[model samples]
Target chain A: MINKLRMGAAGAVFAAALAGTPAFAADNADATATAEILESIDVTLVSGTSLDFGAMVVTGAGTVSLDASTGNLDCSDADIVCSGATDIAEFSVDTASDGRTLQINLPSSVNLLRAGGTAGNAADELVLDGFNSDAAYDAVNDEYTLVYDASGTNEFAVAGDLTFDGSEGPGVYNGTFNVSVEYN
Target chain B: MIRLAASRLSCFLACLAAAGTFGIALPVSAQGDLLVAPTRVILDGRRGTEVILSNIGSEEATYRIGIELRRMTSEGQLVEVSREEANELEQAAMRMVRYAPRRITLPPGQPQAVRLSARPAVELPDGEYRVHMSFRAIPKPQPVEEQAEQAQGIKIKLIPIYGVTIPVIIRHGRLQATVALSDPGIVTGEKQKWFQLTMQREGESSTYGEIRVMKRGNSEPVYMVRGVAIYPEVGERRVTLPLSSEQAAALKGPVRIEYREMPEAGGALIAALETAIG
Candidate 1:
């Protein structure tokens, strides 16, 4: 009986050795299979100086222009002009993947914008504050949306800098630039 | 109709440079709005919902609400979502862009319905910008009051007051945006059929604008692909853009996509792809 038990143990050891045969190559085989599947990679822009901002490629991809003066919210009494309509400069990235699939990133860098409106009171004219941008992902379209992120930012210089006197300013008095953007 | 701004107080720039025109002033009685729609909201782009603006004010006002596009490129440059050509291949999502009335006359004490959509473009690009729903109002001028003592008994200070209050809501568009890169770069006067781009301005109540394509990152775009636009109620057809060789040779960088969903809609620009000589 002891000899039979020893034989059984020897057989189990042999089976375990046989199992190791496939285990060693299993990972490699799996990797090969994965390699066969289509792969997609995205190029993220992470504020790197190594990137040459001037070095660019013009993909055949195209986008529509969404420049409209009506998006400016104003009052009927206020003589807000609609003539300052700007043409949209939408950029596209057509990958080898047929441009239909848009890949949005974390902390999407996009926002909805409203620009160039002014208000004035005796003490201080509450200008548009012009810069508090946030970002969100547009899942249906698979893209990132953002707006001007300048609120609470130190770029405006100072209240004197933020303030404008279009009446007396030259070039572009930078009149009360108040605009904000955020993601959904 | 005036396009209202995100901010409550928009300067009534007598000078015509003001792009959007709308106003901010809560209704005397907070009935439909404030209770129904918040002054502002975090609009989700996928649902393609319609934001309804009600005239909850004591008096009716005109409105021209629309979407505005803005963004920084992958290379950290400001994409022009307000250009005639595709400075970038950025698509306009959710066709949720438009004005209530290019010209409207609202009645007092009645809720007027204006819509802003949150629909994604059928062909969308990448890069996000600070996009906001902007509006402006031109409150009708009130008559100057001439204070005169009606009788010897009582005197009332007749201070003439007038206002144009516009309620705004952001409706989403179901349309989506996608990017399509041209073959390297189509030469000037060169005819190349690379791909067919689809467009839809499916907003609740907004005007549909045009689709534009220009080279991305071009400080000054040399070529443009644009034409007459339309206004639709529900499902309008799609339009195509034909590029010329001049457009191909000089169109550098990615193209910015900008368009309106409603007859006069507004939207944030989306980038499609980079373009250059192959």
Candidate 2:
């Protein structure tokens, strides 16, 4: 009987503990400051120019690689017509923090799927290699140090080589990739 | 040249003064490419709140702001979700959150306010709803020269986009939560030791607070983690916090682990547990 009474008492205590305290009484959980400190950062990448490998008329199957450093293209030995502008992809970063050092995150390579060229409109296989940052500070891995100027602006461009299959489709091929920036 | 409002100018000066006085380069403006204030929002069905977003960049930029779903992992990291992955509760939560100025274009040093409001259905159940509002930077069009340089053969384009998100929560009537700490253990990894604690949450709402571990006879806590959230999605979660070498060594004795609601969040004693460690 005594043990039973003790168990009952413990159960009551447990119930009270579970009830604990009324938390939302005043709707006073105003964690605005902490949240602001943790979040609210924004980094924008504005594209100045797309990485244009120019026009290439392929006579035979071969690879065309673009030098990330100079945006120059090296066509395979196959007879090809190179025309138009061969320019690197231009990007500028705008941050709220002026003159702050940031780490830019870019993928080393991305597969740009050709639109409507694949079976059932699936992504066609096109690989972009050698993601490069134009900043004097070399990228440690795929991340580079972005130094904003006094006006809170930093411009960096990424260049890559495009690998194409022998029989390539002639359409407006488009694909999207993600680049992120954060305070190091 | 951009003009700052008198109040904003004062805030800027004050921030600079504070940074100088503290001697620590507080990540005021230098940390983020974008500046947003009022990081989290809590709506009680009164009026809508405005989240201020500013473009601190040098050139013109466009940003897309939208509400996204996120689920908190046991490790306290938020995982973003796609629409198809959202459950019924998450879908309902998304339906209630309303925000405007979905898209904005601003020049350097320009600020805009995105108004957010929660309009819950009258018959909706009493619970806490949450959505992560994302502000993603959109890339402008390629320059004329680059556009004209389009190649005839297989070409590839890779554009990088960046952004941030904050949680907006809405609480309806008469919600409660019960928090209990269990299965406290010490985990030793290759390079670090961590204190793992499992919090069991039972109720309609979530619990937000600080987790503190104090050694007996010591006034100061040996381990403390802030912004710990026990969201309503899970009935229980295991929270693993890395322990400093000193803290891990000190934990070889009797300790008290408590999950207390943040003072800003109401200063309530959510849960407490005492254990002996070797």
Candidate 3:
């Protein structure tokens, strides 16, 4: 079954190449050779989803985390109070080829600073790190890898821990982090 | 036509409701999703190539392209390296490659080509030099509110920036590599079984392909993984191939493990080992 899917993918690439060859053949009466490489990999984020840790109150200095595999939050610290709904960031990946593996790169750490304030103030920032993901982690190299299924489509989620220093001023804090994917 | 429009409207409303459930004050607009084609590039001469970048999200996104250094570990991970940490060959690779339009703003569902070429320096060594090209989406600034809704406490909004990096390799002169498969064994974990091996690579270039494990008489592979790359920096890469419970049961007795190039690349056999597993 897997081999058939791979062959089908190869046939599609060959058909694309043939489609491009007609242009060259039309320009000349004799046989003309041409080659084209078709795109095989695709990745996109699922709509209407984001990595929300929900709302939390920091009494002193503590951390809150959401599990990637299970969407449960670990807010059992004595210095923090957690409430509301939370979610993990979700992404959908599709590859035309079968048996291909993907390397997922998530940032080691990110900083969420107080909104509408001067940038780069350490006192008003929250640090997010220790990202967890649904993909298999290569402990030796500290990386993550996901394999394409027979259907060539896979979904992965990412969650992380957010730490507060208890000195941050009251207000909304916003930040952005990068997630990268590539053929391994 | 009316139904189509109504369905789209429903989707938009559903998305807003999902966002509101998580305390998001603004409507969700799935931004910064991108797709890059021809994931990795290999430049063997002075000839140039192009990589297609598309904005697959609903909103326009700005992507910043830059060249960075990454070194591969024995475990097949690409770790970012600094300029000072980069060796001479890596630095040379970074200096010679050039690309146009470092920053691009792409509308939703639009694709743009980034043209790139390599110009090897004179008297360059006859080995493979590599650098990673990174495309990162820049996040849009948040709109400032005229009035503060909360006089005390705090709220948080976290946006995920999406990006991808492909290895751009420049092979200057004659380059070759040989690989050997050793230490073939199956490790049974609590919930999974893995076929682990050490791929020992020798020479200038990297070895990239697929690993197939098949029973001696079977014509089909019981376990397979494609796009396994062992870069030049790592002499011996540890490859752990995951197997399902049923596949593991069938992998007993005599088995054959073969590492071959990807099917699209002609599937040439790079290394093979015939062994027995209990």
Candidate with best TM-score: 3
Positional deviation of residue A9's Cα in model 3 after best superposition, in angstroms:
6.9
**Which parts of model 2 have CA positions greater than 4 angstroms off?**
A1-184, B1-32, B73-77, B144-157, B189-193, B242-252
Clashing pairs in 2: A29-B265, A42-B34, A54-B151, A95-B33, A96-B33, A97-B29, A179-B160, A179-B161
Clashes of each: 186, 8, 0
* Two-chain complex of model 3, DockQ on C-alpha atoms against the true structure: 0.27
Candidate 3 lDDT, tens digit per residue, A71-99?
88999989787777898998876555567
Which pairs clash in the backbone of model 3? none
Q: What root-mean-square deviation over C-alphas does model 3 reach? A: 8.9
Residue B27 CA error for candidate 1 (Å)? Answer: 8.5
RMSD of each: 25.3, 14.4, 8.9
lDDT of 2: 0.59
Score candidate 1 by lDDT. Answer: 0.26
Q: How would you encode candidate 2's per-residue C-alpha lDDT over B180-264 as one tens digit per residue?
A: 9988888775445667788999998888777778897675777766656778887888766555578788777788888887655
Stretches > 4 Å off in candidate 1: A1-184, B1-47, B72-81, B84-104, B116-131, B142-278
User: How high is the DockQ of candidate 2?
Assistant: 0.12
Per-residue lDDT for B110-187 in model 1, tens only?
Answer: 322244434445554322212444333333433333222122211111111111111222334343433222333332
Candidate 3: CAPRI quality band? acceptable
TM-score: the better of candidates 1 and 3: 3
